[model samples]
Target chain A: MHELGIVFEIQKRLLAFAAGNGLSPASIASVVVEVGEASTVIPKYLLECWPAAMDGTDMEDATLEVEVIVAQVQCKKCGTVYPYLEHDKICPSCGAWECRMVTGQEFNIKEILVYEEDVPEDGSLGGDPAVR
Target chain B: MVKVYEIKQRVLANNDSEADALRSELKQERKFLLNLMSSPGSGKTSVLMKTIALLKDDLKIGVMEADIDSAVDAQTIATTGAKVVQLHTGGMCHLDAGMTRQGLEALDTDGLDLAILENVGNLVCPAEFDTGAVKNAMILSVPEGDDKPLKYPLMFTICSVLLINKIDVLPYFDFDLDLCIGRVKELNPDITVIPVSAKTGEGIDEWAAWLKNEVTAWRDTSSSETIIAKNKEYDK
Candidate 1:
């Protein structure tokens, strides 16, 4: 499935980001990915593939968080915005099918929650990383 | 301590950049790459056969048939005597920029003028990923109904052209060609919709002409900067 490939892509980016930020791969506490309701990706599929993607990595213990964006559109005729599929792509105000997608097509990495404490790889904890 | 870093980057940024890079590389090589996408049984192979037959006489054509499994399409394309490569997606539903680049490398595009990538027989996922093609086109058969544009808006929006295949069966199927084109145009103002019957070789000349014009434009562009600028303007 493409979700597995997507998970691998996420893992690659996370590793690169971790390296660039001087954070241990294991220091990544969680990853938050924003998926659009109308985007090609399925949130459930991403969730299903996350664990397998992290199985052998240092971020194995890390968790994945998916933020969904509601699919909405702005009617070009009446300047009205409404839920896309909920309204069956018809503008409520003008009953127009021509509109611009305002949201729900985004697939982004919104943020990453990391443990600030530099836990050693040798299993010795210098200080307890506060979980917030 | 716990911290939250606001990355706010697109998950597909990596693939997009790679695709852009590949596009530039193809431009430098003076090759016109076309990415053809459609659902299964949309007459994609039949359209490709007609397209190749029409253009192979004038252009050095190569076809890359991508599927999750099997080389049946590739074998079919080989009968046309054009350079063909079968790209197994390793069970993935679509081909990404990296996979497309690998196929191009394997195809050895030294003497090719037009390289067509027949993407996996899928409508949803293939539209999500860019395969480094100069232009994206998809076929929508008459039997698939006229409301496909409504169901798959992204595919309609991103495609440069739409080929309405199986038009020969228009009398049997209650497909309103005008309505379908109108719906697609509403989503994509610039999409060129052509009705054709791959089985009857109708309207293939127009499709071939479009490809020939694209190949000529891609090759006649003198400098890389001009090509990039033109491409950017065209994309807009």
Candidate 2:
């Protein structure tokens, strides 16, 4: 499926971002993605692809969250904005085809949450000095 | 003693930017790329062949054929004597702008007139990506049923031209022409619908003539020095 390729792209971007930010292995907690209704991406398919894509990687345990953005458009004739239904690209209220898309048609990873290892009070990078 | 902040960045933004660049490049080349979409047995290949045959004498035609594996369609069109490139998607269901740019690089765009890309046979995924094409054209065969416009409204709505393929099969099939046109118009009144049979070469002259006119008009508009200057700036 095309989802596999998309998953690969996502992993590539995620790794690039994590490496750029000096994040270590196993630091990522979750990845939040926003998908638009017009996009062909199926959330269920992307979720199914997550494990295979992240396997043996730092993001192995990271959670994947997908948010759907409903299609919305602005009418040129009536100056009204409304949610698009039935995949119709026209403004429903005014029957205008020159409407601009206000929302939807999005496919992006919005955020990545990571947790750093707790620091030791004794200024040692390895562990707690009190226990040692 | 230290604090860390979460930062969010869009992963696909880079790809979108690349696609935008490719779109501008196409505009600068003064080429109107049409991404033709349809199902496997939808006569897309034949229609393209007919189109090339009719317009090759007058226009500098180029074609990019996308397939999951084989280059059969490209081979078939080679007979038409157009500049054809075969793109093997490997497994992808759709052709994106990046792939299109890659394909175009392999083509001779210097003094080229029109470039037509035949997308992998699938209605859903192909409709999602913009392949830097000036217009999106879709072919719907008769056996696929007249209700397809209502079911797959996105493909019809986004398309500028809708070619009703396999018209010669109308005698055997129960495809209601009136209902098909009605539903497509209901979804997108601005879309130009042309009915034809690529097999028998029936109604193909009109289709080719319309295509030639559209491309000629685009070429005329793009050939102006002012438009060329603006296009170069847009590409940069």
TM-score, chain B, each candidate: 0.95, 0.86
Model 2 Cα displacement at B13 (Å)?
A: 4.4
Off by over 4 Å in 1: A119-132, B223-236
Clashing pairs in 2: none
Best by lDDT: 1
Model 2, C-alpha of A56: deviation from truth (Å): 4.2
Model 2 C-alpha lDDT per residue in residues B153-176, reported as the tens digit of each score: 668877878999999989899899
| Residue lDDT tens for model 1, B1-236 | 66677788889889888988999898888898999999999999999999988888899999999998999999999999999999999899999999999999988899999999999988899888877888889999999999999888888887888999999999999899999999999888888888989999999999889879978988887766654543343222
* CA lDDT, every model vs. true structure: 0.87, 0.76
Clashing pairs in 1: none
How many steric overlaps does candidate 2 have?
A: 0
Give lDDT: candidate 2, residue A104: 74
Residue A128, model 1, lDDT: 30
What would the per-residue lDDT of candidate 2 be over residues A42-73, giving only the tens digit for each residue? 88999998898888986798788898889787
